[model samples]
Each structure stands twice: as C-alpha cells, then as structure tokens.
Target: MILDSSLNITLDNSNNAVFRILGEERFKITNAGPDIGGRLQFSNGRYIHASVQDDPDVDELRFKASGHLDEPLRIYGGSNYNKRVGIGRLSESPSRPNEDMSRFGLDLQDTGNGYLYGLRLTNDTTGTGGSNGACIYYENSNMYVRNFTGGPIKFKTKGAQAMVIASNGCIGIGGITNPMYTLQLGFVNSNSGGAQRHANWNYLNSSNNSFKQLNGNYGNISIFVGGHISINGVIVCVSDKRTKTNIYPMNPVKSLDNLRLLNPVHYYYKDFINNPSQLQAGFIAQETKHVLPTSLEMAGQSIPNILASASYYVDSFKNKIIQFSDFDTSKLELDNSGNFYPYLRVFDEENDIELPYWITISKILSSNSIQIETKEELPSRVFVYGQYVDNFHLLHYHRVFTTFVASMKEVDAELQKEKLKTLELQREMNELISLVQTIQK
Candidate 1:
C-alpha cells in the first residue's frame, strides 16, 4: 500500500523495532544514534539498503543496491557526504561496507583487482535509432560523444575561453575561429601590433634553457642558436657577397707562403679506427694555430678570407666563360715578342715538356676536341657542357694559375732589367767609339 502521509514507528517501548513494507520483508533497527540501517524494496527485483553498525571492527554504514544472490552486476551510490560508492559483481549481500576508493575515485573490485572509471555514460541501441538523441552514446564496448546539433565544445580557464572544439571538429587554441588545420594555435592581434612578426613556436628544456630560436626580426626569418648549427649532417653557412662590406683583396703570395708553412700530414683519426685505410690529408689544428691562428676556432679550423677571394675569382672566371663569344681568340696570336700560345698547357712534375693535366685528362676521356659555344652556334647541350667544363677547370686551374702568375711576374721583371742593361751597354759602346774618333781627329 502507498502511504499518503508520513509514517513514523516510535521505539519508545522496545530497544529493537521492526517495520514491514508490502508485507514481504521486515526492516529492523537496534539503537537510535548517528548509525541507521534499513532496507527498501523499490520494485519486484530492485532493492535499496542502508545498514549502520556500532562495532569498531565492522562497517559504520553501508548503502547498497542489492538484488538476487546470483545477479551478475550491482551498482550503489552511498550518501554523497561520505565520498564513496561502488559498482561491481558481488555474490553475497554486503554484511559490511567496503570503505575503499580506487585511484579513479570509484571502489570497483572483483576478486582482488578491478578498474575504476570516473564517469561512464552509455546508450544501448542499434543502428540509427539512438542517433541525434544524446551527446554520449555507447555501442557495445565503444563510446562516443557527438554533437548532433552544430555547436562548439569549449574549454575555459577563469571563465575565459582557452580552447574550442568547433562544430566542424577542428580544435583551436586562443581563438574560436574554425581552424584551417587539424590543430591551430591562434594569436590575438595576429595582423596588428607586430604580433605576426614574431616566432610562432617556441620550446624549452627542463632547465628552461633555449637551444634554438626561430625569429623574424629584420623582415626575414632566421634562426638564432647558442653554437654552430648543422643542416642534414652538413655544416653550412650563408656567405652572400652582396651582404658583405669593407672588403679588401688578399696578397696571394703571403697567403700561399703561410699555407706552405703549415705542413699537411696523411693521417687517419683514431676515432675512426675501423676505417684506417681512409687517410685524410690536412694540417693538424695545433700546428695550423702556430701559423694561421685566425682560421682556428673552438669548433674546428677553416680557411680564412683567402677562400672567399678565391671563390670570387672563380665566379669571375665563370662570367668570362659565359661571355666567351665576345672574346677575340686572335689575342692568342703572337705578341710583339713573337711568342704565341694557342693553349696554355700548365704542366705537373715541374717538367717543361710534360703534358698538362687538362690536356692529359681530355685525351684520357677522349674529349680533346673542344666544342666551343658561340653566339651563332649556341647548342643547348654544348652550352651546358661548356658550363660544366668551365666549372671543373676553374677548380683545379685557380691554384695553378696563382703560382704561375707569381712566377711569370718574376720572370717579366728580370726580362725588363736585362733589356735595360743591354741598352746601357750599347750607350757605353757608342760613347767609347766617339771618344776614339775624337782622338784620331
């Protein structure tokens, strides 16, 4: 029978009192204290129970959703004030409360171990029947939270929007605008106040140390780092001549002399003991430091500005090749000294008659016949080949040309001095002849 009014059973006469509901089972209580115990059957199979005990070794109170002993699962939420609830498989009715809470805040146990889930929402339905109905739905073991209507899921901090999952499912931080990519970190005032000019990403180590920073400071993007940087396992640096100023030419004689003083050794690094046969030819860093200290840094040694000048001259040679059609080959004809050099065959081994490396290599490759690209006969393939030939020859020719020009200059100075001596001897002979003529007269 449904009670329309409040029913209170006074325990004034008896220490233990029992109350019957639906005439099915009896609810008994022993003492009236902070502890309370009772059972309420809701429907045919479901029941809610609250049991309190005074014994120190027993559970103080236990609230349970109990059913048949063989029932596979049961879930019960105790009073919210107590801070614990349980949902699990229990074979027997709970005689004492399990006051343990798992790490995830739910006391879920099975024999000895069970997982505790903080929150679980499930929808048991098939096909499209549960679609467009709820935010969270479960199909067997899988669960999904879907926004059937076009709306955004926002995460906020201090009531300020921090991140947003938009209707189109793009996640955005700092701005709620739909992201163009899967994840977008937006900046406020991105188009104003120089905000767009700064680095977009930054990273720091545990010690708050920054190793590299990509910045846009001078209207160009560049990286700033503490030490030397490498790209793809190679050390590279930008050296655009146009970006440089205060340039001066190097005295090749002095540089070459300094280079010669640094003795190069054919040695292999002990670190590469496995590759002992790969011998390297280079000057030791300490030995080089004695003569060319400027080339030595903490990291390694490098060629000085001499290489830059050499590179500039190599580029000039390339320009000359590109404009070869404008060159007058007749300039190779005999000068006033009657000496003509159709091709300057620079040789090795210090043998004047020895074949030049360029000629020897050309004959070895069976490419001695040069196909020069002219303005009138500019074959694409020949132009490309000429470019490659110019680049290849320039590399080897520059060093030889340096020494050759130095030696040639010395020889030309001696020739000039000999010519002056010969003229002076002729003058002396004329003066002596005039003196003898005068004595005869």
Candidate 2:
C-alpha cells in the first residue's frame, strides 16, 4: 500500500461519503452533519477520529483525528482539552503572554493519566486550541508538530507547581524538538516561571539568552529564580561540533558584558577617600595594574618591572662569569670602615674585565700563615666604577691604588722568613764544597 502525494478522494453524497481506502479495507464516515456540512474531501478532509500511523521515529500513534471543515480547522487526540471545563476566563497581557496560560484553561485528569496527539503542518502557519482565545493550554502524552515555518510554540501553565516543560525530551530550547510526557524546563514554581533556553548554537555563547522550553528530564535539570547554576549539568552539544560536549564553557571569559551584575565587588560604596569601614579587610592586596581584556578575550599580562630588574642583574652576573675566566675563583674583599669592597679583575690581554676597584677583605680569616686579624684591600678604581649591587651612589675604590705605592720599610713577616731560608741554604752549600776538598787530599 504505497500512498504517494498524488492520492486523492472526494465525498459529495451522504451515505457513501468520504471513504478512506487502506491496504485492503475501505473506511467510510459512520456519522456526518447536515447536507453541505457532511462533505469530506482529501484536501478538505473531515473524519470522526483520524487513524494516525504508529511511528517510533515521531513518538506518536498511527491513527488520530482530523479537524472540522470550518474556516479555522483544528484536530485533537483522546485527551483533547476542548471538552474539559476551563478553570477561569483566559486573559491577555499587553506586554507579553502570561506564563499561566493553563490557569485560564483546561485541567487534565488526576495524576497517573495522560493523552497523545499528532499535528501535520501543510502550510506556512496554522493555529489550534481556540479560534479567538488568549490562555489556551493543552496536555498530552505526546505531541508532534513539524513540516511548518518557524513560528515559536507557546505553552502557559495555570499555577507555579513543579511542572516540566520540554522540547525534545531535553530541557534546552533550540535544536530538534522531542515529543514525550514528563517534559520540564525551568523551575518557577509560583511567580511566573519560564526559561527561553536556547540550544540554538548561535545564542548559547551569549549571556542573558535562555532556552524557552524543555521536553523531558524535569528533576534532572531545572532553571528558576535564585537558582545557582549546577556544577556539571547535562552537556548540550551537536555531533558535528568540535567539542562534542557542552559541559564546560568552550568560549573565553571576556564574553561577559555584565560581569559586575553577576559578581559585584562593593556591597555598597563607602566614602570617596580613606574610609576604614569602606575597605575590605580580607582584600589587602590591591590590583596594581591590569590589562583590561576586550569584550571577548582574556586579560593579557606583562612582565613585572621589579622582576625584570632582578633578572637583568642575574644575567649580568652570568655574563661576567663568561667574560672573566677566573671570576669564579676571585673573591670579594669588603672593608667595614667605609663599606669598600675589592673584587678580583681579569686584566688578561684577551679579557679586560674589571675586578672590584677596591679589594677589602673582612669578616672571614684566610688560610694564609700570619693570620692577620683583619685584612682590607681597596682598589684604586673604587671611585670610578662602583660594585655589582648599588643601593646608593656608585663607588670607584680601585682608582686609589693607581698613584699609591706600597712601603716595604715594614715588610710582612712572611717575607722575612723567606729571606732567612735563602741565607741558610747558601751556608749549607759552602760546607758541602769544603767536605769535597778534604776527600781529594
């Protein structure tokens, strides 16, 4: 029984009017209205109850009811709200549609019962529920609507009870709509609760955008006033997207336009200047300087100036080691009287690196013999180029040695001992020659 788009039928007379031919069985209307009204055409079809096809793909039944032949035709399932009495009169709001459309509308049976429905869209736009009404609402086991232009579907509940509104079994807005019962969206259990949640990829990255509806997963995911975002909610992502999951944010942080609204710094601004009460005690560290990030980028960071200065000094030390071959062994000699330091210099023809202009040894005793209690050596150039670290003005202690000459009038004790050793060695040689002459005789 292959039925393409070309199949057509007509019902003009009363008894044999409007017959639907299935595979082998032919179905005719058991009941009809008056003469002209009873007519049923394939294009303008009217049936007691349409036999909707069963399709798991669409989540609906196979046989179902069609609409009346009036100007604005409509269809409903076994749970049609048309027969149900309205709780109150449907009202209209000038600004936007009320969230409690069902309050002025139909009420389903007690829990443990539901219904199903099917709606095939042929033209660009169509309307159902009532011809001219405001808060028309319906509830069913499953509702399927497709093959139509893009016009948002609206559903309003009567009370703010914990009810779930869903799209395609998903609490998200946009994307493929699902047909299922127990569908819920955000949590607005009393005062006008709604969510414009958009699985719409374009709007997902933007703040203040929401998915308007949910298909299912009520207790699983709910959005409401004063509700904090869950730690790790369900990820809404497409198969084709690079990141197949939407658990974490894929976009950068600066996308936030109203960051102050979310996380405000000042509870209330204190005085203009120096107010002890205004300053937060815990936040002692102030933000010195920060590169304000753009609307959609992370804040950039620069090298700290203080740290850069320190690095410059360290690199200089390394370069000195490389330039001076003996810099590793050369020690620094500092004097306590004037805080003068004499450092070793490499005046080799190959390298002309300056030692500390003034070499003053202090504090530590060396391995040398006449343990001088304290030794201080100042470089003549100390007045010219100062030391490696300069907290104050530069020093050139090494320059003082250029015009100064050492007076050997009071020679060092170590030098006196070496001269005595030379004289003793001369006497020993003379005695040895005398012994050799006696042997010849």
Candidate 3:
C-alpha cells in the first residue's frame, strides 16, 4: 500500500500520519512543519531524530533546539531507549557514504569549575542479588570501581575487594580492609611466594624507587640514582630494640680503647669527579676486622652473626675455672681457634663492685665512596647497619668527646692530690730545720 499527497493530509483526527514502504513506516514526521520532530530512516534499522542536524560527511551530529532544554536528553539503542549503551564521538561524518567513522566509546572532558566528572558510568542491578554500583569490567571480569563521590578508588575481583585507595590518599594492597599508611600490604599467607608485590617510581629520569618482597625473610627496598643515592627527604628505617636478640652488656671503656686504633685522616672522595678534601676519623673495616674480628661482617650479611656462634666458642670455657696469677708474656700460648674480642674489667670506685663488660664495637666501612661505574641496584655497595649508615660520623665524634671528658677528669683529680702531698712535705722539712737550729744554739 502506498499513499502520496502534496497538500496537508491526515489519515486520522489524532493528527498522525504514516508513510510505509514494504509494510514498514520508513519515514515518520510526527508533527506539522515548523514543529517538525520525528525519526529519519537510515539503513540497517538505524534512525536519527529530526531534531538533530547531522553531517554524515564529517560524522557530526548536533542537536538543534530552541529555548530551554530538559535536564538530560538520553539516546538509547532500541526503539524504547531503555537499555544503556555508550555513545562514541565520531571523527568524521557517518552520513556520508564514502566515509566510515565507526568508533564506539565515550569522551569526557573537564574545562573548569571543578566539575567532578564529565561522564558517570554506573551499573545498577539490585533485584537479582547483583550490587548496584559503578564499575569497569573487561573480559567478563569486574576490575575497578568508582563507588562513591570523592571517595577512594577500589580494585575488585568478582565483587571481592582486593585493594583500595583511602580518601586520605593512603593506598592499601592485598585484601587490606583498612589502609592507614602511604603504602600498605596485608592479608597475605605466611609462606606464600606467589603473591609478590612491587612498586616502581621514576623521578626526573634520574632517581628510581623499587621494592620487592619474596616472603618475610627475603626482600629488598632500593632507591637509586645515577650511581649515587641522594635522599632529599628523611628516610626512617624502624629500629626497635625489641626486634633484636642476644644483646650483651656494653663496656664504654673498652670501646674507648679500641677507638684509638682508628686513623683520623684528611682525604678526598675518589668516586666523584669533583672531589672535595674532607677530614674524617674512622677505622677501615678490613683493618678493624683484624683487630676486632668478631665485630665486623660483609655489608649484605645479617647482624648478630657472632651471637649465633657464641655458644660454640665460649660454652665449654664457661664451666672451667682458669686463673692467671702472674704476667708472663714469654710462656703464654694463644689459642688460634678461639674468637677474641676486648672486654673491660672495671672496679667501680664509688659502688665497690666488680663490673665486666664487652665492648660495643662500632663497625666502620671499608669503602666510603659510592661506586660510580654502574647505574644498577647494588645491595652490596650500599651499607647500613642498625640505623647507622650516613650517621656513623656522629657516633664516632661522640666517642671521641666522651673519651676526652674522662681523661680531663682524671687529670684534675691527680693534680689536686699532688698539691696536698707537696704542702705536707714542705711543713715537715720546716719542722726538721727548726730542731737543727735549736741544737746548734
């Protein structure tokens, strides 16, 4: 059936007209002219509203409307416009037969006014036990969610939360429910090695921060820069004494005696091209190890290695009673197998008690210069032990100052005793001269 009219024609009193081709209304102009708004026919069941002026040559479709528009104008895929499908911005006109501008996605831009988001994507399916939330899913797997307004970004797996960025900008990894730190990892198995975590940062194309943990006993956190690490910020490595074990009592006097062996010298850094002459007072690790062998180890080794071997070296001698009555250097035979370190035997003058203490040896460095030949992570090159890497200079100076103060106190006491003895001797000589004069008279 076909109908063609040149003038105003209406098939019904409801002011509706339809033109059909092949039993389908290919074109429908709903209202009268000058108020024209309806669907225009495009091939493959696609239609565009007459309210939009679309240029197919450039893939541009713009809405042309007069006066104030409604809150939102939604364009859906089907005839009812109920299901939500993303709209793509075309680079060229789709109406043109020669041009194929087919790109499917949404483009959101923010110009000003701090508009939270230009586009919001949401999936609200609540009745069938599915959560009503906003998420981005790929390959049938829900990956991430922008759940709340101005809230943390979350990563999820099958609706189970795996990670979150807190509102205060703290990041949490693993199944960590609460993230109270800058970077936190939790909910890991005690012996699992499969769930390794890493964070990488490149700063100014010069410095890099990297961390990798292969279980609790093995891991490394490295921050490096062009063969040298310069930390502009404070780095606080936790040093709670409770984490340590088998700590022996320290002898500050023995420490003072061993410290005298260190060479105080003026030197320049060989690692840098612009070398500056500096004054330094410390022992070389290899040299000091010869004198205090039990106190030193390689840079990467764990601390308190001597404690682990102490029982093997000292346990047998604990039960035996040995005494040295006289000093005879010629008859003494040293045991080469025994580990020897300095111990101070002090008699407390004020308390009248015997105090024996092992020296608190401050292990020094073998190499003070950075290795300039390589730009890789070198754990053996960088040295740190018990929070005293760059700050070892301060500890060495403190030992020097305390030793000076102790020596000054001893000198002052000796001078006072000598003055009193000299006065008494002078009085006795004067009394003897007076008796000799009386006998001569």
Candidate 4:
C-alpha cells in the first residue's frame, strides 16, 4: 500500500509489516502490532533522529531496547562534512564545542588548525579552556598531563597512595604526599619492621642510620648518619696510564725539605673556641700552600668587615685583642661570641718562637670599639689570622698525605745512611784496639 508518494508499506507472508522509502526497504517491524516482544530494524545509510517535545516532564530522547545493545550506535559521515557527537552542545566545528556551554568528556578532534588528530580528556571541551581542572591530551606529537589547579597528581597502588607530583614540580616517591625538594624519597617500613626501607637504589639500615649503595661488585659504600663513612673495597682514582702524559718520580729529599716548612698546629674551630677541649690537629692551608701548593685550593669566601681589620691591641688581662666599632651587632652572635673568635699568632723574642692565641669577643661596648679578649698575652707586634673571612685556602688532605709519605721515605733513607756510617766507625775502632795489643806484646 502506498499511502504517500515517498512512503511504501507491504505485508510479508509471515504478516510482518515492512516500510520502505522511495521503493527501497528501510524499516521492518516484525511480530506485528499488539505483540509484547517486537523488533524494529533499520537498513544501512538510514538515520533515526529523536527529540522530545517541549514538555517539562520529558527531558531525554531515550531508545528502548528489549535485549542487550551490544554495539554502539554509530554515526556515519561522507566526505562533505566532519562527524561529531556532542552531549552538552551541538558543535559546528569538529575541533571544539560551542563556547556557551560547559561540556566535559572525551573529544577526538580532527581539525587542521587547532587540536590535530588525537584524543583529549578535557573539562571545558575546548583546546585551551579548562582552568581549574586537569587534562591528559595528545597534540602535535606530544602528550601532556597538565593540572591547571594548584594541586598534586598522585599515583597509587593497592589502594594506597604511593607517589605524588606536587604542584610546585616536586616529586615525592613512596607515599610522600608533600615534598619540599625537587625529588624526595619517603621512608617505608620493611616486613621485618626492624629498619626503614627506601627505594630500590639504596638501603638505609637502622644501626647508626647507615645508608649503603646497591648493585656494586666490590661491595657498597656506606655512609652513616653521623660524620663517619666506610668503604668496603679499595678506592681507586682515575690514574690510568693512557690518560697520563708527563709523569715522573717525585724527589723524596726535596719533598722532605718542603715538608719541613709546614708547621702542624693544634687548634680548635671557632665554634669550640670557648671550650678548648675539642681541639683539632691540622695545618693551616695558607701556611701549607707555600710548602705544598698542590695540596691547597683557593675558594671565594665572605667575611665580616669588622674582623678584616689589621689593627691589634693588648687588653688589661695581658691578652692581645682587636676591637671593631662599625659592625652589625645583630649579625654578630652575642650569645655565642666564641664563633667569632680570631686566631692570633705572636713572635716571642725571648723564646725565639711563634705563639698562637685565640681571641674572643668579651664585651660589646656599644657599636663603636667593642672590646675583645685573648687566651694568652700577645706581643707588641702580632700577626692575626681570621678564619671568618672571604677567599679561603682549602687543603686537599689526600694530596697532603701523599707528600708526607714521600717526606717520611726520605727521612728513613737518611737514617739508613747514618747507621752504615756508625757501623764503619765501629769497625775502624776495633782494628785500632787490635793493633795496640800487638804493639804491647
């Protein structure tokens, strides 16, 4: 039956109604009307457009299906137009949706100018619209995981937060949520619960809080929480024969002569100046550089202008002192005056030797001319060496030890020569005694 010129309906042998458009089969309704279960099938290249009337109660265009809808309803397009499916707004362009609506979902844009050929998970449905949300997108051969809000991106495992990348670009591993540095590793508890476990690169044991490196053949380098460090194997420097050019044996005698110029001294650091019990034995880099220049390196340092003065004075306690008038008292630690203690050296004319004294800031007599006290009486002319200063001469102790070994070897050789001379003298004395006894016979 042809009700309209464009629509044609025909009844099959099974009494099913088949509808066609322009004489072609487009829709088939099986099992007829009044049946509880019926099937509506559409042909290829056919579209079913649905829309709800402007009723307050009806808000959706829903498709009711009796069985499971296993495949998705796909929209096919020709070469004339781009295919796009939007939930919030009907987008004219394939790249983004209409700017008026807040669309949030996945968008596979296929445009030339904006977001080219990739998948984007965006909140605003545009290329650059989200401000308070995060997006994981791929654009122009690059993939980006960006967070516009001031929050962290966390990665978890087994329902526990394992790692976090903070908004400030700090990465924290092993359940570290708030990292203060560029890369921080958190401490994790081991199964034994005896020590805290770190990442797989290193293991930190509980005893002395020793941290040891992993995956080394010779054994690990262990560094304790305190100042102690231990190496399991011999430490070898890069002294390969192929890397060297002009190498020669060092002169042991010359090294001994140079070593004699270095004066080893027992002194306390400025922090321990008041106690005096925590004394350290070392050579002043400035003095040692003249003897073994290779063992010293010059580095830039800053010092307080008050301690840089060359003036000296004797206090009433027979101690040598230097007073500074113009200085920031706030910068100078008044409670811990020993930290600013200056090392003073005086030449004793009677003993014909140089004596060292530690000078401490005893009194803060106003901003002008603060008084200082020394541990011993200083001579009229004294040389002051201030540790708190700019441009320090730092000593490389490994090279210093090498030079000391050369010097000691030369001393041992000289002792061997003296013993040979003593033996020769004793042989001559024995011969002389034997000849005198022959003359007496």
The TM-scores, one per candidate, come to 0.29, 0.15, 0.34, 0.35
Q: What does candidate 2's lDDT look like per residue over 162-205, in tens digits?
A: 33234333332222244243332333333234333321212232
Model 1 worst lDDT window (10 residues): 304-313
Q: Which candidate ranks first by TM-score, i.e. highest?
A: 4
Question: lDDT at 7 for candidate 1?
Answer: 49
The predicted structure with the larger lDDT, 1 or 3, is 1
Model 1 TM-score, all chains together: 0.29
Worst 10 residues of 2 by lDDT: 303-312
- Model 3 lDDT, residue 13, Cα: 41
RMSD of each: 27.8, 34.5, 21.6, 22.6
| Candidate 3 ranges beyond 4 A from true positions | 1-87, 90-151, 155-163, 168-260, 271-441
Write one digit per residue (lDDT tens) for candidate 1, span 97-150: 233433112222332223222233233453231233334433447655555445
Q: Output the lDDT of residue 255, model 4.
A: 84
Sort every candidate by TM-score, greatest first: 4, 3, 1, 2
Candidate 1: clashing pairs of residues: none
CA displacement after TM-score superposition, residue 316 of candidate 3 (Å): 62
Q: What TM-score would you give candidate 4 relative to the actual structure?
A: 0.35
